[model samples]
Target chain A: MKLRKSEDSENEVELNMTPMIDVVFLLIIFFMVVSELSTLNLEEIELPLADESEVLKSEKLDARHIICNVREDGTIRIQGNSYKKEQLADYLKVEADAEEREPANPSNPAVPPSKLYLTIRAHKDTKFENVQNVFDACSQNGIYKTRVMATKDE
Target chain B: MIARLLRRRPRSRSSRPKAVEEAKLELTPMIDCVFLLLIFFMCNLEFVKQDGLIKAFLPKDRGQSTGPSVTDLGEVRVKLLWCAPGTTIETEDRDVGEVVLKIEKNVYPRSGATPDWEMLYLDLVKMRDIRDRSGNPDALPVIIDARPLVPHAAVVGALNACVKARIKDVTFAAPERPF
Candidate 1:
């Protein structure tokens, strides 16, 4: 009797999953880093639409921009913490001082104190006085770069 | 003689059985976790960052009066009047009833009657364009006087109209009178 060849009897194709898994893992890491960096702590609210509103392209360059939110009920929140107008002013003063003392760059230590930008995100129905109060706080602390957040009109 | 020589060759002392084949990596669980993370991030990603910004200059003096009788100032004034719904009871979260936009002698929607923001926008664009053609500075200041009872949305709508006309210098009048 003739001996049957074992290798010829079991000629099956197999897929190599190593490269696919490596690509999937790379994509996962990329998304994780982007989501963490872009997350905003403020609550989402209905912002007013503006025809002439300009896009903020320099947000990534500046790390000292202050973000404040005003709810529909006229309450102000900063970094997820509620604050009365008086307390908010005090808080802004401390932030302004801290920003003034921080160096623009570690390598270039001779730069002047960079101006702090205050970004106010208020609901469409939020009282104007609520925004004005935050404005008052910024002026009192000598922080003049103020921006009101609005939706771009399509 | 050759067959006898091959059979007589002794096995070397260092010769040993080869090690078993390396274990295969489990990819099923790892691929599942990766797909889950990919979905989570895709849902949360905000591509356009739809929020825009309007730069504002707050009064440094806390809106204190400087003086009176500056009538020579040729700034255009736009007034926004808020009207409550014709109901006996008013709730804390009552919807903003109606808004009337007024510019000089002409009243929008109707003369002290109805609220129509579309008409107000058209009129504002017309006035702004006429001034621009008359060699006036493009950045003419507009004063938006809103009532104390006016909802902020109403004021923003008026502001949107002014901005649509390419008029950037906007200042809000102090809401002094009690509603």
Candidate 2:
């Protein structure tokens, strides 16, 4: 049998692109806005107010600094990523290793604990044992410079 | 002459089609990819952490006792006590069943037997002033002795009270009884 000529070949199809470009621009804007909203890598928890809490400034918002979050349900999250409680120390170790290297001072050599800073963001309602476990993990992994985050009381 | 113009019209339409096609950037595929990316981001977005950092020392490792002497109560020893769920009486000031804070044997809200952070802050301020009046150049360290079962909020509440009083030297004491 002879092949039949295509029926739609007589008409030239032109695809409209304005809507596509408009949608793409919108998507790019949406992603950019949401990404900026997530600068801190943790979940929002009701923090206990300390009338005397000091406002601390993080050195760099990058990987050199790490955040460990303990939710009210005792779930542990590291840098917005979930981790089993048993694996907390290993995660901190990996993050510490990934930290940027610093030049060792000749007079006062920096120790492993001094290299990276660890921050614990525990929920106000979370059990003290949960926070202590994470703190123990920090101690075990040689993470000495640790900060417990809280909100200033009104 | 008429035949020549007609021939040029067909040629122009065919040849100029390439320019028209090039002007239309075929952004549908790119838009599709962006939509996929947007969906990925939306599905993965988690809650943002809004709490601020309060510089606190980690607990002393097990069996390592480098803490100050027990006689240094004047140095601001804020003890946090956790009550059983049913034993805690509901107070107008604090939520029911919250941990209590004690400074120098004086419990917050001496009358209600509930957590009163404001009163705790005043005491810490006095302790800080006493330390400063003693002519100590170094910042005075405040010991936070919290029970293992106490909620972190109570510990943080005590710490915040100290920090709000400008007592920055904060340290956590090992739980008297391990969990």
Candidate 3:
């Protein structure tokens, strides 16, 4: 009689943990995948500072625009090479053509538009003529959206 | 009659109650989850934020001419005028100690004709050096009066030199020309 009672008590103490552990492991995998897709390029470039002014909101991605760095000593660097104001229009025209052919999605037959957005970084002491040349090139190339890079005032 | 003989008799004492199982917390898995979230936020934060260091002084409205006098008493004004190959810089309205011309040079040995950027840089440096030694560094604001025909790249070059010299205040005075 005593042996039969002990066996019945042991059978009633069973616990189920499969469902709880399944939820925890699912959350871990989700976060791991999201972290991988949010990486961005963090390069060091000097941006001109502006006075107290309202911020201009823009949605253009960095890859879609041409970045030009104008040094204080009248040196125009486009993608790391020195260029004169007169040479900018021709160079940009070639770049715009190349961008049109290299579609972001190769599977799609439709090509992306070759609209160029220019981001200019000028130093405080730079001559007005040097900065003006860049603006002229953009207009000549049919690129209307020109943004001057400025640091936020704190 | 045989089954009854094999069965045991019940005890006269009362039976004891069954006890419940104790619940305990597991912290190892929870700790791992917390660490993963911490790493995610750290990587996404932008550390080196760029902000504007220079302040621009806009020209006062012509209607409000009584606001303040526009003078070079405590500021350094650089007026840039465009000239043709043989045209003199003094023909413009502004006065300066000297005027430098930026002409294209041939730098490519193979092509025999390439634009040289070194001369432009040298001229800018000399201009900045002259401005720095002129007066009190903190009191003087650098004013750039650009000609309409000047190239945009030249203006950027001049601005870059001011930044290199750590001049925080700059302004643009546009010429009276129909755009």
Which prediction has the highest TM-score against the true structure? Answer: 1
Residue-by-residue lDDT tens digits, candidate 2, A1-154: 1234443543548454555556656776887777765654656677766644555654656546677878998899875677876788788767666665444434224323435778888888887878887876766655667888877654
lDDT of 2 by residue, B54-171 (tens): 7776533322334465436456677776654434333333234456666756655542234677787887788778888999886777888876667888777777777778876777
Order of the predicted models by DockQ, top scorer first: 2, 1, 3
Error of 3 at A35 (Å): 17
lDDT comparison, 2 vs 3, better candidate: 2
Per-model TM-score (chain A alone): 0.67, 0.65, 0.54
List pairs with backbone clashes in candidate 2.
A50-B160, A51-B160, A51-B164, A52-B160, A52-B163, A52-B164, A53-B164
Number of clashes in model 2? 7
Q: For candidate 2 chain B, which ten residues in a row score worst on lDDT?
A: B2-11
1 or 3, which is superior by lDDT?
1
- Candidate 3 residue-wise lDDT, B1-179, digit = tens: 22223222333212533463333455456547655665554554533354332223232222112334454455555444454333433334222212333322322122101112344335445655676788556533566655644444334445545555555555554334343
DockQ of 2: 0.32
- Candidate 2 CA-lDDT value: 0.65
lDDT of the structure predicted as candidate 1: 0.65
lDDT score, candidate 2, position A125: 81
Q: After superposition, how far is residue B130 of candidate 1 from its true place, in Å?
A: 5.1
- The alpha-carbon lDDT assigned to residue B148 of candidate 2 equals 68
C-alpha RMSD over true interface residues, each candidate: 11.5, 8.8, 16.2
Q: Candidate 1 — which residues are off by over 4 angstroms? A: A1-37, A58-63, A97-114, A142-144, B1-27, B59-72, B86-97, B104-106, B110-115, B129-138, B175-179
